[model samples]
Each structure stands twice: as C-alpha cells, then as structure tokens.
Target: MAGFHVLTGSGSTIAHPKVRRIGVSDILDAMRSGLADFWDRPSHYVFLCLIYPVIGMILLTWASTGNALQLIFPLVAGFALLGPLAAIGLYEISRRRERGEDASWRYAFEVVKSPAIPSILAVGAMLMAIFLVWIFTAQALYAWLYGPTAPDALIGFIYEVLTTRQGWTLLLVGNFVGLLFALVVLSTTSVAFPMLLDRDVGAYAAVATSARVMLTNPLPILLWGLMVAALLVIGTIPLLVGLAVIFPILGHATWHLYRKTVVAPPERKRRR
Candidate 1:
C-alpha cells in the first residue's frame, strides 16, 4: 500500500500506520467494554487494584512521620501523570482477551519479553521525569505563596490553603501548568503503548501515530480527556479505593480506545 514509510537499519522500510477517526460514542463504548472485562474476570484483577491503596498508605505514613506534609497534594496530583505506567498489565489482559484467550490476571505480573519493552521503558522514564518535575514545581509554587516552609501540621496547612489568597493563586497557576503537562502526555501516549503491543513499530512512530489520531478526531479526543479527568477526580474522593475499579476500567478501556482510534499498517511487499 502507498503511504508514509520509515527506513530501518537493515535498509528496508515499513509503512507508517494510520490513525482512525473515532467519535465520542466510540470512547463510551470502549469504557463500557473495559468495565465488562473487569467483571468478567474480577478475581484476576483484584490484586492489581490493591496496589493503589498500598501506595497511598505508604505515602500517608511517610507524610505523617516526616516533615514533608506539603508533598501530599502534589503526589496525589502526580498520579495523573503516571497513571499510564500502572496500566501496563491491564493492556496485556485486554490484548489477550481480545483474541479469545484466557485472561488470567497472573499474566499481568509475569515478565513481558516482547520487543516493545524498550519503548515501554522509554515512555515510563518520560512519565516519571514529568512527575518529579511537577513535584518540585508544586513545592516552589507553595513556597512562593505561603512561605519558604511548609505548614507544620496537616490540618493547619489545610486551613491556611483554604483561607488565603496565595493558596488560590497557587491553585490556579499550578492547575494550569499541570493541565499543559497532562495534555502533552496525553497527546503523546494516547495510543502509543497500545500500538506498541499491537504492532512492531518504534516508539517515535507510535507516538506520532497517537498524536495523529487526536488531530484526526479532535472532538472525540477532547471529550475522552474530559471524561478521564472527571473519573480520576471522582475516584480520588473515596479515599483512593475507587482507583482499583477506576484503573482497570480505564486501562482496559484504553486498549479498546487504541484499537478503535489507530489503524494498523497494511501489509506490503518489500524488495529484499
């Protein structure tokens, strides 16, 4: 098929995959399918869900035992940036299940030896970098607004944050900056990882294809992002337990989203 192609080290070339035009209804359909997948094999997904609460508890303990109380909200918000990494296993499950194979949860933890590992790790590093920078930036914004020191106590700090102009300013600016970071990540990886699993393409190609899909279907992509934000906020409200359910649903749904939005390359003949 005639389209764009990327040259490989072996002097051969592979055609670039195409992005599909998706709609708001497609996004909803993916989520619905993801939820069904979870219920279909709930036990397989249980342990993965527990991971979030464990991490939350550890963070809570660290803040309680340490002086870095201000780290709490920043860390909480940082989850938004790192959410993609945590969903890797769910992606695998979705992939396997899509083929009508047994979707055992154990496969989620076993070592993944696919050629896509390097690209997956590359994307993971990118996410962690964003998360660390976000933490530092959040701390600086807090220091600028409140003072050089974080609030001595959690409750007092909460009070000050609610009753001060500095807090409001910091909140507004911080959210704006975070939104930019999120959009960048979202645009870059919206379908990148899933594509990696579905195809043998390199990370750069996958990323470009992901962004292409968004541009091809802007309205649906916008609605999908908004829906993700709302779900995350709602999931965070119930002491983070909602994350167990939310994570798998979104993770599985994301696989479907990638499948729906990105078109695989058509097989072609190449000169040997």
Candidate 2:
C-alpha cells in the first residue's frame, strides 16, 4: 500500500515516500477528495486561486466610470498573464496526492517550493509585457487611422472597412492568430505544472512535454480548450464572482485530466 501522511497550514516536516506510478483515476479520485468538502464547507476553498486583477477591476469600476473602460484591456491581458499561476493550484493538489499526503487550500501556495516559481513568474511577466505592447500598438493604429477625421467619415469608414473584403481577410487572420495562441498554451501547460510538482524537472521541460502531449492528442485537447474557454466566459458574469467556485473546480478537474493524458515516469530503484 502507498504510504499516507498529514499536512497542516503551519508547515511541518514529513518524510517523502517512495513514488508510485499513478493512473488517471488516481488523479480524479484526488480531485474528488479535494473538492468533497467544497459543497458543505465552501469558505475553506473559496480563495483557492486569488486573481488580483478581478478585484482590481471591481475597485476601478467603483472608483471611476472613465477608468472603467481602461480596466477591460488590462483584465483581458491580465487573464492571459496569470494563466500559468492559476494552473499552479492544480499542480499543487496533484503533487500533494502523489506524495500520499492530504491536499488542502494551504497547498496552493506550496508551488513556491518547486524552485520553478522564478521561471514561472519570469515567463508570466514577459507575456504580460508583450500583451501590453500589443494593446498599445493596436490602440495607436486605430487612433492613427480614424483620428482627426470628421465624425461621420470616421463611422462610415469603420463600417465600410468592417463590411469590405479587406475586413473579412483581417477577421480570418485574427481567428488564425487566436487559434495559434490557444494551441501554444494548450500544449505548453497541459500537464506542465503537475509534472513539475511531481518530479524535479524544470519548467521548460514541463512545457516541452505538455506541448508534445498536445501534438500527440490534438483533437481531444482542442475540445478541452474550447470547453475551458466557454466555461470561463460564462463564469465571468456576476462580476467574476462565479470564478471563486468555477476556478477551483476546473483547476481540480484539470489535475485529473492531466493525469489521464500524461504518464509519470516510474521511480528509479536505489542501488543497494
């Protein structure tokens, strides 16, 4: 039988047991275990993943109507930025179970122990910076194209451009760009965080393996991606309050899904 141990919020030492090969069902069971109490004791898991920007938007909206529009660009950009961090919680839950320990809300913060925190943060920061550049560039281009023109001319031009052949071309191009981005994210982080947590592998390897997994299972992964996107959009209503419930469930479910898709390497026997 696999060894079992306890975990607490104050943090205590427990010996690491021998690693065992786990199946997808094992991961699913763990997810069910983690969320079992969520229904009856919702408060305990409410803060599983703290999305700062959501709160920032609420505050900005409350503060100024003028600044509210500004929040949209940042909110969209920020979600992309924090996607990895949000996935970290799933990694934590899976990692804890792999070690035969109880996973809890406190374990969500244990990702910092993986030595991957720096790389994760660095990658997230770079992505956010790039997105900011894109947002500004898009705004600048729109201003240059339509600014200093008569109001009627500007509106008419926009309508014409949107309905013209050129507009359809641009729309198709935009769709392709979005598809590419989704595929990149799906492949890179599909099983990345949990892999990193389960083993001593670097974040880069985790990303590489995740990408490989996506390449191997394109159809199912694509369906999964579309499902996640749809659910997230639905959860955004009620001012993102729904996320407090939806995010954890999805995070836990993803851990189970990752386990199903990626096989963990067996533990090497020690030389006697």
Top-TM-score structure, candidate number:
1
Cα lDDT for residue 52, model 2?
38
Best-fitting candidate, scored by lDDT: 1
* Clashes per candidate (backbone, < 3 Å): 0, 1
Task: Tell me the tens digit of each residue's lDDT in model 1 across 1-272.
Answer: 11122211112353367777877889999989989889888766867777975687687778667878887887787887888777888888888888787779977753266545666776678788988899899888888777777578889878777788877787789889888878887888888777766665666677777788878998898788888888988888888878878888888998999989876546632211
In candidate 1, where is summed lDDT lowest over 10 consecutive residues? 1-10
**Could you tell me how far off, in angstroms, the CA of residue 144 lies in candidate 1 after the best superposition?**
1.5
Question: Local distance difference test, per candidate?
Answer: 0.76, 0.54
Q: What TM-score would every model get versus the actual structure?
A: 0.90, 0.65
Q: Which ranges in model 2 have alpha carbons more than 4 Å from their true place?
A: 1-41, 50-53, 56-74, 77-81, 97-100, 122-176, 268-272
- Worst 10-residue lDDT window for candidate 2 reads 1-10
Per-residue lDDT of candidate 2, residues 7-116 (tens digit) = 11111332222223344445446457445534533564576544633664565464345423322433443464345556676557655655567766676677776544
Task: Name the TM-score of candidate 1.
Answer: 0.90
